[model samples]
Target: MSRLRVGLLANPTAAQGTAHRIGRQVDHLLRLAGISVVDLSGPSAAVARARAEDIRDSLTALVVVGGDGTVSLGAEIVAGSPVRLGVVPVGSGNDFARSLGLAVNDPESSTRALLHALSRPVVSVDAIEITAAGHSGPGHRSLALGNLNLGFDALVNARANRARSGHTVRYTTAVLRELRAFTPLPFWMEIDGGDRIELDATVLTLCNTGMFGRGMRMVPDARIDDGVLELATVSGIGRRQLLRLFPRVFAGTHTSLSAVDIRPVEQLTIGLRHGRMLRAYADGEPRELLPLTARVLPGAVRLLAEPSGSMTADPKDSQ
Candidate 1:
């Protein structure tokens, strides 16, 4: 049999210093396994993506070493392509890795597991294709392998992304800070060709995978292979109730609350009423302002993950 050839893409800015070290270790391990490895590390996302695009035709798989942002970049490169994608979770909020049931918080183990999975069959999974209004120019679309979120969650992510220190705590602090000033926004959504429904919502999320915010089960019943997106909406609630609801998300028990609504959908158009400027984030990366359409691209990409057993982990316990 021919030897396996894979490309390694490492995000140098991911996890501050952890990603670079993990990439080196993973590259060493793959070499020991007799796999031909290509170092695709770059100074920025654009360069890294360009490197992947240049080498994609020759590689059997592309292993991304970083957080969700790095993985999101990889998804864009491999989406609709024949190459399979592997992930090494080494970011602050490894929600994508957690959603895949991949081991997080440990680089060596996750890298080993990724290698083992690459040796087996690749798993086909769904991805979200996002097209924002007024941004449909060539190469204007975005891809998300995990979840897309708006409203208060997007605000918190924006704040967290701007912070200069900490990981999970940064997100938590952002959430707390934003809650003090956040109010429900009027959202209008058309789901799977259904009628447009308007409601006051604190947050809205479109999920290809169930978890976000470092393993919060925002949509507990979501499945990556289901060929459908999960829409989750949280209605207006007081500050104390919102705080209480957030902790429950780690256990996926927030779904039981009356203010929370979750449903499976194939496509949706979302916008804010009164033309307010609303931002949406996919895989923790910011997207264009709202009034966008999103659809589930069934089996759009192949992922290398755990072959069997449960891959999902409790964020609370892991943290």
Candidate 2:
């Protein structure tokens, strides 16, 4: 058998450590596995900065070590290519890893689990392609692998950006602060030529995977290989309703709320009716904004996941 060559796309800020420390841990683990590991350095600007084509050309598998943003970047870069992608959840919200049954928080265990996954069966997962105009007054496209969120979640992400720490405590502290001042934005959505829904929504989420921030099940029925996307929308509601529905998301049981509208479609476009510069977030990172097209990329990525991580048996999957 050919030896496994792995490429690591690491983010020290997201890893909650200095670059040197994170690099040493990664290098030591990969060496222990007898696998060749290459470190992609520099700022965490975009996957393009890593010279993705070269990594794909040389590595047998590429592993992303950071939060959902880095994972999303890796997904956009390696999907549609033949390379297999692995994830080591080191960031604050390891949402995708939860869906894969990968344990969170322990680096040593995560590394071993990922190495074991590399030797197991592989599965193809879906990704979402988001097309938006560049802020530089030019037209361009952006891609996201996880959920695309608006309103409250976007606000939470923005607030977290200003935080001094990158841990879960920082995220929760920001969420509490944002909740006190958060308000929904007026927006409209069109799904697969369906009727338009106008709403002043607290949050709008498009889910390709079932997990959301820190394991919230905003889209309880979302599936990674179902060839469709689940749009979970929460209308403007008071603090009481919001409080009641928010905590239940961690258990994938948020569909109980009356204000939620779940729509499954192959494509959708979202726009702000007033042309205001509203914030949008993809995979917990900010996006340009409204008037964008989201297309489904079915089975576009080959993922190395724990043998027990398959969502095929979950009855809640949105197929």
Candidate 3:
């Protein structure tokens, strides 16, 4: 077997108090496993990405030691490259890590599992390619290995980003605050080259993985390697109904409601009819404003993971 050398990238802002501590543990573990660990972490995303690019050639795999945003940053660099990606879930909303069957709640176990996975073959997974409607610059395009969210949830994320406390508590507080002032806005969606369908919606999500917002099963049927994207929309519901349905997302039972629609597509174009410059979030990081096109890039990246049960399994169900 070839010698293992990994580039360790971490986002210190991910889980706050525990990220750095867990990162140290991961670094030590990888070294103990006889793998060369290169520190690619930086004070910011831009600096981290620069560091990753600088050492991409020497790495057998790039191990991400933060949350979904940290994974997204690593994905941007290693997506089409030969380097495979591994994740240790150290973020508050470790949705992508959960999709890969990594232990989300326990960093020590997750790091151990990741090390085991590194000793095996890699698996290819899908990623979403997002581009701004009128921007053709290099930075205008990006990749997401998880979900892209807009509308109500994005508003909550914006608020949560500004807060300085616990992730779950901050997110919950943001939800309540936004729910008190937010309203459904009109949006036009075009799917797989289909005609435009306009509607008023409170939540719009394009998913490659099944979960977002820590553990919300927004698209329960989504699979990262399925070579397709899942589109989910919630409309025709008042704030009261939406609040009631919100918790159901954790169980993925909200899709059974009449006001929600879920479908699979290969590409999507979304624009806001109200001319609101709503922000879009992918992998828990902010992206450009509205009028975006997202498409599935099948088997775009190789992920280091052990074989596990299907992603369609219920979250409440035992693994």
Q: What is the TM-score of each candidate against the true structure?
A: 0.92, 0.86, 0.92
Error of 1 at 140 (Å): 1.6
Residue-by-residue lDDT tens digits, candidate 1, 1-319: 2367889998998888679888998999888878899999988888888988998988888999999988888888888877888898888888888776678767779778877776565677788989986465438789889988877889999999999878788999999999897889888888898999998898788888878898799987677876898888888687788888998999999898899988889998889999798789988899868899888998787776754332222222210
| Ranking of models by lDDT | 1, 3, 2
Whole-model alpha-carbon lDDT for candidate 2: 0.73
Ten-residue stretch with the least lDDT total in model 3: 310-319
Q: What are the clash counts of all predictions, listed in order?
A: 1, 1, 0
Q: Which candidate number maximizes lDDT? A: 1
The better-scoring model by lDDT among 2 and 3 is 3
Flag regions of model 3 displaced more than 4 Å.
310-319
Clashing pairs in 2: 221-318
Instruction: Give lDDT for model 3.
Output: 0.82
Q: Name the weakest run of 10 consecutive residues (lDDT summed) in model 1.
A: 310-319
Model 2 lDDT tens row, 1-319: 2378877777667756543365568668988878887776446445444566566777777777777887887786678876788787777777877767776666678788768767666667888888763232113656676788866777787787778775577777777887786667788877887788788888788888757767788876677877888888888587667767777877767787788878887888778887767768888888767777777888777776643433442223211
